[model samples]
Target: MNTLTSSAHLVNVDIELEAAVLGVVLQTPGKAADLLRYIQKPTIFYHSLHQHIYEAIADLYAQGNDCDLMAVRQWLKSHGHDTTNLFNIISQNIFFDLAPKCLILFELAVKRYLGQYGERITRMASDPTTDALQLLERVDGDIDNIMGSIQSMKRPSVNDHLKVFLNGLDGKAKNNGPFTGLSTGIRTLDEQTNGLKPGCLYILAAGTGVGKTAIAGHIVKHQILEVGNAVGFCTLEMKGSEILSRFVAAETGYSNYELDRGKGIDPYKINDAVTRLSDKPLYIWDKPIELIQLEYQASEWKRRYGIKLLVIDYLQLVKHSMVKNRYERVSEISLTFKEMAQELDIAVLALAQLNRDHDKREGWKKRPKLSDLRESGQIEQDSDGVMMLFRPHKFGLNYADSSIIITPQTLEIHIPKWRNGMPTDEDYPLLAYYDAPTNRVGSVPFPDVPF
Candidate 1:
């Protein structure tokens, strides 16, 4: 159309254009055809003239200016737009499409433009309601489209993939329950915790050198070797190969120290560990700084390789990009990890460093309390269960003295909080062995320890 005809037609078209724009701005449907035509030309006025109009409106909004049509015309002229045509156009062209949405958007742009009576008009339109079930069905349809696109774009979240995962887990749990669970492998520990649940956050907390890492490694080996569950072992402090070597040493009954020292153990034990790992569904990631990278990696394993359980060697070393304060940072990491567990639908077992307060106390009893977790109290709060690894000998007690300490090589699997079950004494004092050389854990009973 010619410029003159378009300008003259502006009066006839203004209402529809305004209504269509307002509808789009308000995220309303049923006016798509109108908007499609209007936005066909994003720049009808010269880009410079359009630029001036936008800036003037923005300035009025910012300064809380209550400029009338004449003032707005003057402001436009001052800003160098050809005001002669624009002034005549804007002043006489009826604002035909000024719907409830347009009015509200305009009021937000220039509050002073909405006079005293405009408040009542806004409230009336704003309070308009719709059918609840219809709205829900519409929303559900929209969400289905969105989630479908998401699943297509990347991997399905574990929760989304859970039924398939659970089918696998159910079959394994049924078949392996005979070989592994409350009565088998390690009896005392299993009674309290049961075997680790998928999509769970298990925090194994303890002071340094208290067999936490060893115990975690042991759990991984047991689950991988005995139960046949796929494992993802992530360690921040130790190299993946180092952690694997420990697991291998533990599995093959070779002293890790002998291997490290190039001493007496048969090389066949190391070969056995390697051969076993190659065949098992166990993946290890030693690099621990990137949380998103870790999630991305875990997602790959879950999607491509069927990784069932995720084990992070410890929590404090797990980093985040957003947080500044160490304590608050840890809280965010803790929540993310918990969500990761739920999202992946795989059990996440994280090791955490307990506070030194446990060590400073008298009488050499060093059972870690929930409050003693370092960095964040949220660790205790977010965890499905808190398991503490307590070693009396680590506190300088005689590894042989069962009478004074009760259990030397035992882990106090204290379920300070169990969301799903209760903690009984039979479940506590889960037997643990700290193989110093290979750092392998065993289901060694506390009372059965040589100490």
Candidate 2:
């Protein structure tokens, strides 16, 4: 069997493999549409002819037209794509193994992507004027694109989506009480937000010294750690060791300060906490990351460890090169984080900072508005829900005044914008204990639960 292999001069693309997939699709158009749709992108093919051929067949099938040789040939001619190359894949030499053929082409496309990007990186590196840090950023973005293309190309069809919906609708997904999403284990917060649902993006925005990270740690320790659902906690603000120390503090009821300094806390309590947390599926990445790189890594976490949730320490820290203006950059970041949640079928909880505009509102009234989402209004627009944290006690409000009716120890979780269910009370926020020394946030004194 003579395979139509590409000449050595061309990029290392499998011409025969591309032809094989095309031949199989041309011969078998009955199951062709889904097959082509699974391929998703025509750019996977090495040859321009194969790319157009796939598109023509896909278009024919999509329009409820029969994709016979005559139909495909005519479509190609009408679209101004070459028809002479059609003869290459018209032969009966190829097997009708559609999936395997497509898989090979997918792999080849990734290799070609790497090679192309590698050459570009080398060229950029040779240019002496290029800023070293900027060059590194561009190179990382290019690599991320290659990885992202693989996940993007695996896009599911309508029927594929129908199965997931029907599976849950028919009760095959099982009945687990009132909520169906990943339960944050805070009964009130979970009940309100429906447990940080999949395909939804939640923003935890607050002023500095607020209990945003504490509550996030509590949720992870109490729920995710308990259920053992893998969570990818991307910390842009803090180091892995710092986050881990806080988690330990939350667990052992020791201050993160003492835990880090190794002074007041007992070594055995830290050991016990570490041992218990050892089995939990929590992955922490503590470094600055660009948007594409972050998305690529999250996808890898979803693939490798089956991460059900992604917690970004602070939204503004994730770098973006596409836009020069801060507002546009934040807008892009927020939108991509939202898309990533839907794409990976996971919940994204991004910690963000509220603008200082809230500070002028007087004592015990420093509550953040949706409009106060730091750099862009797009964060509020893109989010499924926005949770803002406000600790009046942090402002040195020693006692609960009659008007405010809150103490310094009390942590107020504000739900100014909730898309799922409206339990938002701007005037009076949800009540929780900060437990500062322990670095824990919850109703507190839970004998059974983790936090």
Candidate 3:
């Protein structure tokens, strides 16, 4: 019997544990399927013979057949493998008493994997040509893989998950709580999404000059100023000063042009805006950052300020050095955002650019769809909610209500995909007014049809 050691040590095979698990499975064929819940992959077994035996059992189980010793032997024989020696060893070493320790087997497997990954990373670091940032990302990915393996061993069953969900519902009802997530300040958007739930990746997509940044700023400001939630905003497109100016314009109702040009701006109002927002827990990283760097920054913000929400201003601008191809890089970034949201237990709202093909389309065909997300469809698939900003007036469509056509054009926020709730179809699009000068967006009453 081999004792499991710390993960820092070199990995060794645990033949005793492997034999015990396989013996129990052979004794009770039904137990093979149950064993899979703890350790699914055959590679988790340290011994080659044990790996073969596990694979045979898994195949039989998947085929809806019993996996007793005879069946396993027959299957191995049919595959031209001599299991006589393997069966003898199993019979001699069988210890059904240790069947409950299968979890320990899974733990050892994870530890072994991590130890191997550490060696690989050390080798990579020794190479002078290896990019430091790329190496860091690779190491982070390996660690995530190791952690995922450990988590899988203890993952709850469907019934167990249902119980926890029902308990949450009961608690919500008892406490008379309605919103389970942070509010976006748009009433209809909040109602439709039940606010932005933690562990969700939301995509806010729009074409150029469609006020995506304005909408994201509005949401972050509402979170930090009104709801008193900490937020981290990462802007790859704009500088920190520019973002701050927008925030000030949005918060104080000052014209962005006036602020930018330093003309006709009241000094007192600017001072007041600065003083009011000085204490808000809003952190911004406006420099160009890769996905890994953003993850580190977001984690630090959460650790330092307990930030509850993270906003990435325009996903297309995020850089990744590991993958050279634009499409694959974007796909990796999108998946990374989703994983980061879930791992950090924070809501991530990422702004994305729509493809230029939408602009080439004719009337009504120009509206952005899920497929129009630039670079990769992974952005649309990975997002928990996809909100596409559309302004018909931008395309020279006149508003029937002439008053509404003035500054702050009517903006239609089309949600093509909402994983938790209903999506916007042809008939319904969330209506809002985008005041570009003030860097603000607010909900508007749905106008009559045929406009």
lDDT of all predictions: 0.59, 0.76, 0.77
Encode model 2's per-residue lDDT on 1-451: one tens digit a residue: 3334454556658787677677776776554643553476788887878788878876775454667778899999999987876876867355754665666678788888778878988988899998999988887887786666565556578996898789867763577577777777666677677677889999988888787888787777765567778899998878888887888888888886687688766889889989887867888888777676677678768867889999998898898765789989999999999988997789999999888888988775666778777875788789988888777666766344565455665777788877857757777567666777778666533442344
**Could you list the CA RMSD of all candidates, in the order they appear?**
17.1, 16.6, 16.4
lDDT of 1 at 240: 79
Tell me the lDDT of model 1 at 376: 44
Clash count list over all predictions? 10, 0, 0
Error of 3 at 244 (Å): 1.6
Choose 1 or 3, whichever is better by TM-score: 3
Best by TM-score: 2
| Order of the predicted models by TM-score, top scorer first | 2, 3, 1
In model 1, where do residues sit more than 4 Å from their true spots?
Answer: 1-185, 396-410, 424-428, 438-440, 444-451
**Candidate 1 per-residue C-alpha lDDT over 90-186 given as tens digits, one digit per residue, 9 for 90 to 100:** 4333333434433333333233323433664455446558555665586577557544423433435778578766876787678845332212134
Worst 10 residues of 1 by lDDT: 32-41
Tell me the lDDT of model 1 at 450.
20
* Steric clash pairs (candidate 2): none
